[model samples]
Target: MNKQHGSHEDKAERYELKQTLSTLQLWGIAVGLVISGEYFGWSYGWAAAGTLGFVITSLFVAAMYTTFIFSFTELTTSIPHAGGPFAYARRAFGPTGGYIAGAATLVEFVFAPPAIALAIGAYLNVQFPSLDPKHAALGAYLLFMGLNIIGVAIAATFELVVTVIAIFELMVFMGVVAPGFSIANFTKGGWSGQDVFSLGAIPGIFAAIPFAIWFFLAIEGVAMAAEEAKDPKRSIPIAYVTGILTLLVLAIGVMVFAGGSGDWTTLANINDPLPKAMKFIVGDNSGWLHMLVWLGLFGLIASFHGIILGYSRQIFALARSGYLPHYFAKVHPRFKTPHRAILAGGVIGIAAIFSDEMIKIGGQTLTANIVTMAVFGAILMYIVSMLALFKLRRAEPGMERSFQAPFYPYFPAFALFGALVCMGTMIYFNPLIAAIFAGVLMLGYVYFRLTRSQRETPPQNEVFEPSEELA
Candidate 1:
């Protein structure tokens, strides 16, 4: 009788874990994770950062990304729950901090889909010429929703396949563009204000800093797949770090080879930057330009797919814990994917089309404001997560850890500091932009507090006691 009861408990636990994620699926989450941050939206307004600024921003952000991936992997493995940052904060900090962490992630995950889908529209306009950016953006998002509704397995497969194509394209661009690279093109001063302290190009480096941090963003999707991974401990860390490393290499290569030395004349007209660089280096007839555009489009498509794939999981996770609407927790019976939440993501994308594509502020983008808002929101979440990590180590020393953030206080501290600097630069150069960013986060907090007060009780009966893992 005792043996049978123990077996049943094991089976129940297995079933719950099975619903989380598998290794391959986690890989999909990993690749899809960065679409909004850089891979999807890379072209939009980066030039405003200028060439030297852009290259500097890209390299600096890549380092930050690698460090954070390490941090997240450590936290994810320890928590083993669906509510990623929430679980980490709860473990490291107290429940209140956990709620705030969850709140910030909610903002990032919620806002990200639209931010990405909006980007897809911008590029599609260049491709089709006749296509409206808004329509193209909406069409792409609808397709992503459809695929996600079909299944995660399919979605993961798509993410893997597209990431492969993107990786190859980046490699080809480096291999071809390396020969023509001009060293002088990269260092040219941009948008000058001689005051070395200013944020224009120098200061812009700080303000535009967030623009450069693209490597392996969507990889947070791995956390969403926590229930789906075959061996959550081993698989998540391997895929998480490896995928981030691969992206970092590609990002750096593009910076070196594609964005390398060129005359301001050649660089000035370079709107479709990467594709134009490849064509410039290899002659368009090599059929490489077509391939570059296609690959970029595919990567962009993959990014949107990832947005739906990754963020819906957040909804599923929050819902399962009773922190969000239970409908978000529902997985399709036939597909085993979160169809309801997948559609819910559409709300933000559609809103972006209305707000940015439709309305303009001073003949400039509400879109630009949206982009800055996302960066601030993501940074806020990063801040909460890092502090939570420090707290987690103090409380959860007894918990089994699959991965540890390297250099102890070094990497996490620097990453948090970098995140702060990035945010400050962004706010300083673009306060109207920054205000929009801070406003969104404040709104979320206000909403959460109001909702919590009205409910009168916490979401779940579960009590999360602190572990001994504090630093």
Candidate 2:
């Protein structure tokens, strides 16, 4: 009796995550997780493909994400687990597929924070010239992780507040830059640095795939918070559909306004593109420039803080499934957060920030390299997730689906095709980063194989069950 009671207590402590997120909070998390992309990373696409060329790439990627979220929503509402793609793949393809999906997600969530943190640092540097961006980045990791560890409700409330401000600041940026916007400036040398578009621009378009993807890269991370959502079936769909629409408008608006304001090439290859673009229109000493520098940190903060939430849930989910050390699965007794997993992800992010100068690949900055690596993970997970969607359709047709993906086969199929194309193009353009991504997966698989016998059986919550509505 004592043994059984102890086991019950352990299970309770290990699996609890407070279901406190509302639709607005979920929307906040959905948008917050990817909004930073608009502030910084996507400009690098202009470096690779020029303004018009990158515009084409962004539109294509935007289409891919639109379709992907529609299809992915069905799975989230059906499963409603913190694992997101990891849980879906596990249900459809069992342990190995789960490992692949989980590992890919870990890569995506883990690596993305460092890049955003560095951007936050860069934004801070614009205000405080003497501060080291790396040090600032490290401080960001520490501060946000503590916030996340405090509790889900607190973390999500903060996300909502900051995301709203970030969105408003972006609108402010567009309004302030509108007077200087010139079509001639936007189109000049806009096709892979050529004045006109041609078939010759194809290579640059392919090379720009990852940076273009940055715009909506982590929006799907909303799925990670589904388990913690109140009435996930109703809230997930609303948050996801609305969130994608919001991001698409902001991405196009921000990109066009910035490109048209000045020589687009100057905005490329920098972390603080919005402020720099504003400086062209407002000058170096303007209040508008200072406002952007200060408020801009909110965009980076939203993503950095939200992703820290995302990575911890993924780490906790993976560990609970016996794919990682059980220590990571522990929920804090008081806070109800995955404290260990949060800290673990933080350590990796800090290490990447420290290695910014030490590690070089393809002559890209640390931000660029990590962004590419995260994109590789995201594309792989997307492919596997769409496959899981198809598999579950056949395998469990009767499962309760609160939200069915519109267009069914067509929507998922298009998403799959786009993911495949992006993955192939990314590999062609970034062979070294692709190899490093592969190496991480291979090492993870080896560990799985070696520990197969000792692995614990997954708890009941890790498995899917039809909703009571179906019964």
Candidate 3:
């Protein structure tokens, strides 16, 4: 029995997949990343606000991300493994800074799910007034969180359904809007949002860039599903390229298409703009078409599913690394999912329900402070990773590369340039809010350095063999 126990442990190790995913899964995972939970609103908000100029501005911003994705694809194809930016930073910065880079990302992954879950609750409340939106959000967050705990395959399958709904809705939208698109509407207010784009326009733009650039924020999926990709090298590159391009086309297309069809004043104010646009194009004949508008509804569900998967993996990685409790790293015996991490994400989300504050900002709507916090964290991680990528290129010039970032210094240079722009924009738009987020990251960084223990994350090469033979 003792021998059997040891054997079982070793077998678990065999299946541990410290590094296991394939390329196909990686690509699907990449696609899954961009169709993030918060996007349904993000894009709609960008469109309807009629900042037609701003929407176009946003499309330009979205286009700018191509450079970053290509650069990442180049890296993913070459490096093509998990730990993502954390993996990259670790290699470039060594233990100290690497750990720091990854820790910063933890802030992003950790906060994303709750932000999204909360958003779901808000939308539900909007649809059905009496539902205690917060309660609906709580229940919804818990249900999907449970789905994520099942395993990535299940999550991916569920998420694929959501992505399909979202994309189909968008595609239908494009088809409907294209014929109705009047170039006159687009050019009429081509320069309308001029007020918001003043002397502070550049700064404001930079601050907003973080919010817009990677509307998908799918980079987390690279690391989370790294272990499951079929051919991470070839598959990831294709998926990375396809996913980014697809989103870029679909995302930019819809809003730009919508802006051409109508003005910001008209489009922006409607509750569900995309669906509303469909209604405008198809009319009541679209009661069936309205069903398609429910794509955002399906999207909300999918976004919930995907974020849970990404966050759970981050938790699993953290737990395995010693940054979090060990139990969180546990893989389900049969499911092979990070059951503990799933639970942690769920509990935190549930706990957040208690703190849901309805703040009146963009015209009397209830938004979670936690959502903004998540954005701050994601930006911080990217900043550190940018520096890491820069240093790595210089410090370890000889590191093998199957896929070097195109245009050499220029390609990643573009990403670094663009990333900075976006970060600056996010901050400019929300001064007090951005400051609080920065403070939290600073606090987390300090806490980690102060608490060095056996709990410290061990490297991939380290053995878990402590007293194993003795036992």
Using TM-score as the measure, the top candidate is 2
Top-scoring candidate (lDDT):
2
User: Candidate 1: worst 10 consecutive residues by lDDT?
Assistant: 454-463
lDDT of each: 0.64, 0.92, 0.59
In terms of TM-score, which candidate is stronger, 1 or 3? 1
**Candidate with better TM-score, 1 vs 2:** 2
Taking all chains together, each candidate's TM-score versus the true structure is 0.84, 0.97, 0.83
Q: Give a tens-digit lDDT track for model 2, residues 71-115.
A: 999999999998999999988887788889999999999999999
- Ranking under lDDT, best-scoring first? 2, 1, 3
In angstroms, the error of model 2 at 168 is 0.5
Q: lDDT by residue for model 1 over 1-471, one digit each (tens)?
A: 999999866533422323544566566567656733434344333445656666667767776777777887888887766677777775666556666777666666666666666666666665577988778778887888998888767777877787667666667667767778877655554443233346446655565564564334445657767756668889889888777876676666665565563543343322245665666666656676667666666666666787677677666666555456655666676676777777876777677667755545434455545555556667777778888888778865777887899988888887788778776776676767566656765776565555553223323323253332211
Clashing pairs in 2: none
Q: How many residue pairs clash in each candidate?
A: 32, 0, 24
Off by over 4 Å in 3: 1-22, 36-39, 43-52, 77-81, 122-129, 187-207, 266-271, 283-285, 352-354, 358-371, 455-471
Residue lDDT tens for model 3, 413-433: 776776676667667666766
Q: Candidate 1 regions off by >4 Å?
A: 1-25, 35-49, 190-201, 261-272, 279-286, 357-367, 453-471
